[model samples]
Target: MSDASPVHFIAHFTVTDGDGYHNYEKRFFPVLKPYGAKFITFDDNVTVLEGEREAGRTVIIQFPSEKVLMEWWNSPEYRELAAIRHQATTTFSVSVIHAIPQR
Candidate 1:
């Protein structure tokens, strides 16, 4: 995939330590700003319409491009905050999906 392609960061997790996760959330937006990340949505009550996938807290974020997203993902600030999230959540899963090219 090209760096110009837009991407979405989708995450699902169950918060085991609310306080730690909350701390991560509070600090997330500021670090995300420089990368042109757009907050799509977050849902604590996700209903699985199909499949047997277990749904927990769901977060969706859109980045202008994969290049920008990777910069943010690999940044030190985000890494520090992510450590907190790792300790707080269980069944954690994250997926980076690229948007299809314009027809």
Candidate 2:
């Protein structure tokens, strides 16, 4: 197998408008497919074991590389759908993380 590590796109957000957020969710998976993105986890049942916990939903998506991740994020189709997410959520935060390879 190739040693390339996958990159994760992590999002933490609180929904302000459920219907609007649901609209965004409907389009999420289809848009991701073209970029080879896969959902690692999407959870609302989060527990904090250490530092301060933020109240919201957490989503983790994985891509083969940063380039692929950016391509998905910067796509015109995604940008259009992202507006729905912006309108539906409050305190949205997204981060890209590179997985560390095991020795």
What Cα-based lDDT does every candidate model obtain?
0.87, 0.86
Task: Put down candidate 1 lDDT per residue, 6-103, tens digits, no spaces.
Answer: 79999988888989888988998999999998999999877778777665788999999988998999999998888888898875678889987667
The per-residue C-alpha lDDT of model 1 at residue 85 equals 84
Q: What is the Å distance of residue 91 in model 1 from its true position?
A: 4.6
User: Cα miss at 10, model 1 (Å)?
Assistant: 0.4
TM-score list, all predictions: 0.89, 0.88
Model 1: CA > 4 A from native = none
Put down candidate 2 lDDT per residue, 33-97, tens digits, no spaces: 98878899988878888887577899999999888888888999999999888899975678988
Q: Estimate the overall C-alpha local distance difference test score of candidate 2.
A: 0.86
Q: List the residue pairs that clash in candidate 2.
A: none
